[model samples]
Target chain A: MDGTPGGLSGISAPGRVAAPDEGVTEQELALAARNHGLPLEALRYDVTPPGLHYVLTHYDIPATDADGWRLTVGGRVRRTLDLDLDALRARPATTRRVTLECAGNGRARLTPRPVSQPWLVEAVGTAEWTGVPLAALLAEAGIADDAVEAVFTGADHGVERGVEQDYRRSLPLSTAADPARDVLVAYEMNGAPLPPQHGSPLRLVVPGWYGMAHVKWLRDITLTATPYTGFQQSVAYRLRQSAEDVGEPVTLIAPRALMVPPGFPDFMSRTRVVRPGPVPLAGRAWSGHGPVTRVEVSENDGATWTEAELVPDPAHPWAWTAWRTTWTATPGLRRLTVRATDAAGNAQPLVAEETWNRGGFASNLVQRVEVLCTTEATAA
Target chain B: MDGTPGGLSGISAPGRVAAPDEGVTEQELALAARNHGLPLEALRYDVTPPGLHYVLTHYDIPATDADGWRLTVGGRVRRTLDLDLDALRARPATTRRVTLECAGNGRARLTPRPVSQPWLVEAVGTAEWTGVPLAALLAEAGIADDAVEAVFTGADHGVERGVEQDYRRSLPLSTAADPARDVLVAYEMNGAPLPPQHGSPLRLVVPGWYGMAHVKWLRDITLTATPYTGFQQSVAYRLRQSAEDVGEPVTLIAPRALMVPPGFPDFMSRTRVVRPGPVPLAGRAWSGHGPVTRVEVSENDGATWTEAELVPDPAHPWAWTAWRTTWTATPGLRRLTVRATDAAGNAQPLVAEETWNRGGFASNLVQRVEVLCTTEATAA
Candidate 1:
């Protein structure tokens, strides 16, 4: 327990990069085996089925019984509220289609990759989350004037970077109390009870922010007088260029676009193969800064771009926007790329190196696909 | 088209081994991200929820429209029957808790690992699948006398090892016609319409065979006069010792046991930590050969073993058996392991090398966990 960070032994320092050419380690593979990401092609579904939605569980999906679960709201609150599942369900509920993207979405593509979950994009999904608003719960509990942040603690527990504690994260009181933020104590996903991998009994759904802010397997909500300095909040999920730098906290997801890889894919390389003809290319675009205003596609590796048509869905303003375009295919290998720009003027970086960070957070590199078009009448 | 194994360029050979020092390739990582395994801890549930169930999709989870989709029974059948989702669900529905394990469950751990979806021990799950029996459907379709095999085709199309085709595999006509086999045309998982990833519209659920036999996104069932020699049937999923070996086809799941890793896991290494005391260890064991008759635990890395008590569930004969044992722990590092033996006398090998093969199939090595016990009252 000496000065070692998190007081654990045999743990790597936070944000350590793997040596160049070092492949994904067993540790990273173990994490990958436990967690999963959405298949880019699943974008065809407006609301991703819960099973296809990406999942990132830092610890075990705690075995929970909904009937026995209780959520306690306390700390700097005027009146602490302890409620059961039914009690919480009795409140007026609202369902919102919200998109959630992992802060470390494109981590593996980063050079000198940060050795964590090793995600290569695909860490995004949108689902209809149903629950009572967090603002309403806060109102019921009656927040004290001194409360500055709302710290959420989940039931799942494990040691990360030597720190042994339940998974926890905090939101500023300003964000938590704002009704427009649309944060929720979500108990259901896609109209069904939350699956075990998705925090089962109850969880948090913070629309328009990176996934870390939306805590799962929630057990307690404590209003704090001072800012929460937990490990996940103060040390991890930060955009830092170097180990010594105190970086800015990663919050909203950066603007990003991903095309459903056109045509059929090769099993090993996943390179696409298509028959020579007019190829209809379609994909999804999203941003937390604001609604995605524009989406562009490039068939020649970003040398030239064509503005794609955006299919607006007024019902799901917080979910990803659908975009489509047509590409006339001749016989040759082609690199296809897509990028999105949000109303706030935020656009995805053209390459991974541009958004490089020690922790690999907010890496919204443009999505690229290698496609081969052939004249063969029957080619997969 | 040149003499490449599957007529595809830049694709690795069917049974190629990755360089020993090379890390997991981006392509393998992409496959891993798209597919997922159950968290070992999730074994605590009797019936795994649909989202927690393991999935291995050879191609895209084809965007299936249940209303428009149809299942065709043709080939050597007396009458080719085309049925919609409603037609399948309207038949006598039977629900059974079946456990499925990928043939390549422990592929990643093999030395000179197979260059595919690098799975560990998590590639197994049990769910109550609801559907009409395949025997019933085949009986109604009236298989012709010459039919020797029933080839099942899924809608998912892709190129594998240079060969382009829809995902297809076959079962012996005898196996498909046996009512005792309990093969099913599954449309629901855990009482819900199958999730897109699990196979929407309809899927094939072969009760005791390896997951490869359970064709998902089912499109057709063709009763063939001769045995089907498709790529997935004849080349892939075979247990071969060398590249040239024709090898035996992998079918039934080998007996294996996996412990719900004791205590909590370190975030990076996944090493278990526990306070010094009597630690209760529990896990699930299953086999395609027969009901799991015995389970054993080893605290000293398989040096000595003790039998564990098996909790039987009469309803789920094809699902995993629950086993538990208690260990008195002192402060030190210990390697814990578990193995299972089925009624047919099949047992898990002690080391992975014993089960290694060129294609990395059926590697049911014993499950091992490195556990650290400490005197500290509060250690994760």
Candidate 2:
């Protein structure tokens, strides 16, 4: 056996040591291939732009022309300024890789799934966002001490919660003006001009917050003395702790992990079966609140837990951490689940039922998988 | 079972089906965990900085502080300019994520492994490189038609092939001045200043090329009227096609695929055993010459092949593609192998013996892995 890259020796070399046993069904071999490492089809693993971006607008996207696009900063500011696309691009541009996830990403996992956009975990993605920092523009406008919030408005208009309005959300003035936050008015995604589905021309990207804070098709930024009680801010994304509790606006993404489903593909294809043996599993874990500190996998239905290996470098402070583990098999069926814990000591729940709200948001549940294994005799 | 994210309903849910006959042993359960996915300790998989970076230097790294660092441009130029780190940063800066690999990576796999920094597959890594484009710097110095190549010299000096000189390599003048090539005089790695081992203040990063082209601790750029015959360029990295052939200078990386070894961990730990059934495997595929188009995995010693799923978005034009596949098993030792085919039609060979160089560089051999699978009865 040859030594590994790290100088570890005595490991066996790769190649066939034995042939397949006689009468092993052709279907079984295909099944093994099909059910291989994490199912790509089931996961939104793409971190680059222009891939499968989770579209969840209240209305159809409005076609915006670059010439017509303008960003206006007014309200509780010393100066009201209107700038075109070119003007914004002329500013000092900074690029950062950030992970954005829908606040309602795992809503479909709820028993009585919400009636709105039915999203599973695939609604999350990461990309390189390049543009002027929002703090720079806000600094030019000069904020008033009385301003409590900064409201961001998009061009897409629709009726929501019995109110006709453009898509808008507000951030606390502190979050809007904090340079360390790295919030940006983004015009590019993954080094290319933003696609129509992702905010084109301009969009407000509040890094470390859920997707709602990223107001796409951005048109205006308004500061106000009181908090903006917009439909999206005060109504849609509120997370209720219990039936009697008044919900609070959901902002940061909780610690969460999703294993690549077995047999994940680079592209969609037919399903394959699995043989019973040593199965390697992998997935990504992330937290909007803090860097993920640990991830654990449960093979006996969460009865006992073991730590999974986390990819050390988290690309970005806000990007997801890749992880892996294994599940040995017995010839029947088995359930595999994964949980994540963040630096803030927040651990993902076995079931995300506790965070369920009227809007069915913030479901960081322990994701589970079930697969069948067959013995050689039973298969043949 | 609920439908997968892609809305495919035919897939079955995961869980236990039936109990195995009185044979399966507890050791098999441990095997499942040990070979979980990509043996982290065995490979360098850091996508972020401060992780394991492959180091290969002929001499001691020259400790040059930024205060003393000066880049000089001369030879065949209308203007010779010497600039320091501060002056270099004054120019427009661009950041790109690119993968870098040693030309001698996988050199350990050669039949008669050459005497050098023995690298297996783990000598490769990807990082966000930030710096000013070399084209901009060259444009300032102006080039003449007589200039055929630009020689880049690093601070380290050593004796190689009976000559004592600083590390140096050259690129064609056209390639050195092409902005589309995305070459950079990189000063930062993964958002932070370059670490001491990674070139400290400055390095030359030629995207889509082997690590030898990235001259660390860069100090001088000399425009040459003819081809460079430096020891490194003439002897070390030359890829000889055959005994009588004059090997050309190696530039782009070949198509290669590496699977995360079963029992991969964040850190090295005890080896685990395997059960009898299906096993899932995954790894990364990449090519410096072109984007990886396809990857195939062979579980039965290469008797038959199956297409493994590739990670859809490559994140960068030059980044590696993630892939996965599965193996159905009978209770015995097994060998698994993976190969990558690039858009250029360059496929990894089953045996890399043909490409073996006297210096043992560029070994894209079809990687083989050996594993053991035991039945409950035999294992117990």
Q: Please give, for residues B118-230, the per-residue lDDT of candidate 1 as tens digits.
A: 99889999999999999999999998999999999999998787778899999997889899999999999988898888888789999889999999999999999989988
Q: Interface RMSD of every candidate?
A: 3.2, 29.1
- For residues A78-98, write the lDDT of model 1, one tens digit per residue: 999999999999999999999
In candidate 2 chain B, where is summed lDDT lowest over 10 consecutive residues? B28-37
Please list the C-alpha lDDT of all candidates, in the order they appear: 0.88, 0.66
- Model 2: per-residue Cα lDDT over B1-380, one tens digit each: 21333222223222111122221111211111111111222232435223234444444344568887899999988899899999998999998887777787766456554534444455666788999999998999999779989999998654343233578899997789999899999999888788655787899999888889999999999999999988678756877644355687789888888876563211111122245677777777788888888898887767989999877564577667778777676655567788999989999988767768766677788777655454321100
- For model 1, chain A alone compared with the true chain A gives a TM-score of 0.97
Candidate 1, which CAPRI tier? medium
Best DockQ among the predictions, by candidate number: 1
* Cα lDDT tens digits for candidate 2, A77-171: 98997999999999999887887777866664565444444444556666789999988999999998798889999987533433346788999
Number of clashing residue pairs, candidate 1: 2
Clashes per candidate (backbone, < 3 Å): 2, 30
Q: Look at candidate 1 and give me any clashing residue pairs.
A: B6-B162, B6-B163
